[model samples]
Target: MKKLVFIFLTLISTNLLAQRPQTEQGKGSLAFWENLTKLCGKSFEGEMINASENDQFYGKKLVMHVRTCEDGKITIPFHVGDDHSRTWVLTMEEGDVIKLKHDHRHEDGTEDRVTQYGGTSSNTGMSKVQFFPADQETTSLIPYAATNIWWITLDDTTFSYNLRRINNDSSINVKFDLTKEVDTPPTPWGWED
Candidate 1:
């Protein structure tokens, strides 16, 4: 009787866990992705809340356009002043992972040497926040940036992009106001499609 009771309890426990709500580990589910997709085809003007001396270049017109929204990816072109050479490509990876890559291109539609460098989410974060550690590719492409960590946050009113160096005193944040939609910016470089 004791053995039979133990087996029954074990089965019940397993079934309960199976019925629990899906979470970050639910690879096919993307509540966070859906939140971002809501901004498709929209543009927002952002102000650099925090910046180091190196980020002075972005002091010009800062705009982020949620340009493309597809099955499992989003392409946002970040325009800094008159330079439209940077695009942030976020793609869903292998179920529950989100990968963010910086695609940089030149005027003649050629890949820049310092392009395609970004990181993948380290955990299944909440729908509002996702943290991406420096991936191997990013480290290899920019050796000094090996200890970098980037994250983006999406809330009802504001969407922010942030970068920080691990154990270092370097960081920058650009926060866009989602409450007001701005005029869409021009197409980014190498994006005639």
Candidate 2:
């Protein structure tokens, strides 16, 4: 009976510790997420390349325009393809983590892409974001490869979306250093209504 009581107490203590959020640095204020979102309002450019030896067709060059208002309304223009034809929407998913959801949008305000995509803030508090592809199962999304890690670094004026795509377990990784463009280009490729 004494052993059973000690085991129950240990289990309860472990459960309580697990319930607590990680606060080694500070409270889970999620300041990193906010800072990353700020990159959207201005004109920025980035690239998405394949991390494979076979060379897959990923967005090579992209111009991102993140627009936001005082009322908290926001929109991010994501251009893709060689002609820069497609536009993907980036919206904030209100929660503790400040998740960003992406989807293809038409002029009529409908979804165009067959699958939805976006990313969630990492709980590790390491200033990282996870990219989520719609076709992937939820269980497989968290442990995303380093290539899927779109490391966004920004200054007061300029920003860089260091998009990386990890193709294999080896060292060959495709990299795109998307620097901010001064002028905004026309609407993306598939902006038609």
Candidate 3:
């Protein structure tokens, strides 16, 4: 009877373990997701650190609102100056991967022509950072962005959103101060009040 009970316990434990992510990358990705989720409903102010003078984001007021957090998805609205046209949607996928999509919309809440372009993390990134290479959909939507690589890094003090174009060697790096929570921005374009 003792042997039977021991075997049953072992089987249950093994099965439970099997259901969890087994790879380092998978575990790290999950940790990253949890870290980001902690900031839901908060807002932060950002500055463009590496943009050229002619860049649209240069000297503009940048804000990011961690507006929504659900079971498997988080939506963040990125407001640039008076433009509420961009939102970042992070969706947790199977195998501990995260998909990052850029949701762009007009003032009237209509989808933009080049919308929903982003990528998925190819491997389990660090708990504080994740890299996303342009996915097929991104390239299809914007051919010039085929070599784009976007990455986000989050730490206790700051959260950074970055983009690098491999072909042109151009990059955009914007850092948001996380230590201070700012006023929540207005609802992003295309989102219901």
Best by TM-score: 3
Give residue 83's lDDT in candidate 1 (0 to 100).
86
Candidate 3 vs. true structure, TM-score: 0.86
Candidates ranked by lDDT: 3, 1, 2
| Candidate 3, number of clashes | 1
Candidate 1: stretches off by over 4 Å: 1-29, 52-54
Residue 84 error for model 3, in Å?
A: 0.3
lDDT-better candidate, 1 vs 2: 1
- What tens-digit string does per-residue lDDT give for candidate 1 at 1-193? 9999999999999898888656533532267788899999999999988564567755588899999999888999999888899999998888578999999999777899999999999766777888888899999999999988989999889899999998788787899999989998888999976
The estimated TM-scores of all candidates read 0.84, 0.48, 0.86
lDDT for model 3? 0.92
TM-score of 1: 0.84
Predicted structure 2: lDDT:
0.46
How many clashes does the backbone of model 2 have? 7
In the range 60-164, model 2's lDDT, one tens digit per residue, is 555666644233234555554344433434333454433444455565555564324444545333334334332233225434442353444434544444344
